[model samples]
Target: MMDKNQSKRFIQFAAECQSSALYEHLSLHIAEDPELLELSSYAQKGQPMPNLIFGAVHYLLLNGKEHSLKNFYPSLVNQPETEGVFTYFKDFCLAHREEIIPILERKLVQTNEVRRCAYLYPSFCYIYDKVKKPLALIEIGTSSGLQLLWDQFSYSYGTGITYGNPRGRVHITSEIKGDSTPLLLDTAPPVSVRIGVDLHVNDVSNPEDKQWLQALIWPEHHERRELFARASQCVQETPIQLIEGDGVALLSQLSDQISTDSLICVFHTHVANQIPKEAKKRLTETIQEIGSTRDIVHLYNNMNDGDLHLDYVHNGKTYNHTIGATEGRGRWFEWNIVD
Candidate 1:
């Protein structure tokens, strides 16, 4: 009855999601099983998004649902259209409500993608050229402080364009979309100071938090999954300090700690869109206040979309440009230079 009474908006969302990006297995299974609508009766607000669905799946997989994951999951079996998918899926959902309910209650869809450092390279290089010094960097909404270390990874975006740490643990490659390829930095400038600010921070060392981080990744994306493993390993060798607080509240204070000699850069990818209008306003004001005192570059983009843009202030002048676009997980990049 819970599945029968549960709202179908999530199912509809699943259908649309499959069309846009390639998360067909999770989306399709959910769409086909309207019985899952019964989950609404247990509603943490009467609905669950794909994130909640996958969260439950991951929790079970990481714990004790090996047979369910192995036999039924599309990512594992390679077939969402296979018969009995919705049947087994429904059984799992219904049977595991005890576990799924609390997960649905938490509503955590937070994902920290490390490969996006591939998208940030060109922007960092541009800022380095302007300031000609190492960067003092701070990140907002840094779930695990992973992407905060983008410069530490190597990238091969287009055929001839290669950059970043070649010896780096994680290697990211993206396709070129248009004629205007982005400027490549043979070597990324050094990042001397790095800090992360978030309402809740994930400790990479913690096993439960790490599994949750992995759960946020779409199932079919093994490359991204592997890359995340590498980056996490990289972090163990060099950890960035994470400041637990609201991003805007911490921005000014962190910016103050940066030395005048090194370039100051505040950046976030796929983090801004989740913020409400009022919070975004505060972030904008905080950046502007910092800009008034000195030059700083803000590298940013929204969730799901690959485009990376630059907003920076130099000598009291503000400028904006679309630096490039890449796969959501930074698989490839079509660097767009705005002249």
Candidate 2:
């Protein structure tokens, strides 16, 4: 087995592989494969990868497919055959490269989804600090309510294993970087408000939606499957205010209704990528206009748009945390400049 340093570098190598040869090869392979063609029937230029494969993969990976991904040998590359499981996953990617491209597209290639994925933990940390009491958070583009349950639980990072360690009943040592994390009303109590918005909100509890979520999972990645299952379960029991509407339009409307003292945090992840340039501009303008009057704070992800430099455009100081599936996944930053 590889040592910690080697494993860390391996992750870095994986990060670099994201947009280079691997990406190009997968794209070309998928374009020619019939399975990919069938899977991508509903995928337009802007739409996320079709629902069928995504849901199926999500279920398989999370519920029962950990062994396949964790213990398989990679088929593409021959070098660095450090362990049995890693090699199996590499083989899975290479052998079924064509069939699995769409699944990867949905998870990593989707720009909007990438943005939302990064925002998950940062937004959680931001709210925890800002709201002293239990929060009533409304998340935009919450594919499943995994992010919303971030504060409701805790996590333990171990060698080659990560599991669901609940917060109240179990004491898990986790460090959150922020001024303050919102204290729950009761150790066992749920947050005050939990809602999700998606153009097509995946009903995580529904068997069909679960299937689509499974398909969304990349082949042979079981850790994520575990995460998704826990998250899906959270959404199923929690009463979420999920609605089908344009996020920008809905947020504009929601802004008007939220009381000043209610701690309104308008958040969106991975959803902005679907928004047109004109729509994005309008949304920003709307937020700026709204911020002029009310005490509102937005904890959204930084877009790759050259025009909007959210990295340093803060009126106040900014705090940045380097985050992603791998190290240096750009900066996961937050700051309350409006205050």
- Give candidate 2 regions above 4 Å deviation: 1-28, 31-42, 48-134, 156-191, 305-339
By summed lDDT, the worst window of 10 consecutive residues in model 2 runs over 305-314
lDDT of 1 at 63: 60
Q: Write the per-residue lDDT of candidate 2 for residues 13-45, one digit (tens) a residue.
A: 444445333322343344444444444443345
Q: Which pairs, if any, clash in model 1? A: 2-38, 3-37, 3-38, 6-37, 173-331, 174-332, 174-333
Cα deviation at 221, candidate 1, in Å, is: 1.5
lDDT of each: 0.71, 0.45
Error of 2 at 321 (Å): 11
* Model 2 vs truth, CA RMSD: 9.9
Question: How do the predictions measure up, each by TM-score?
Answer: 0.87, 0.57
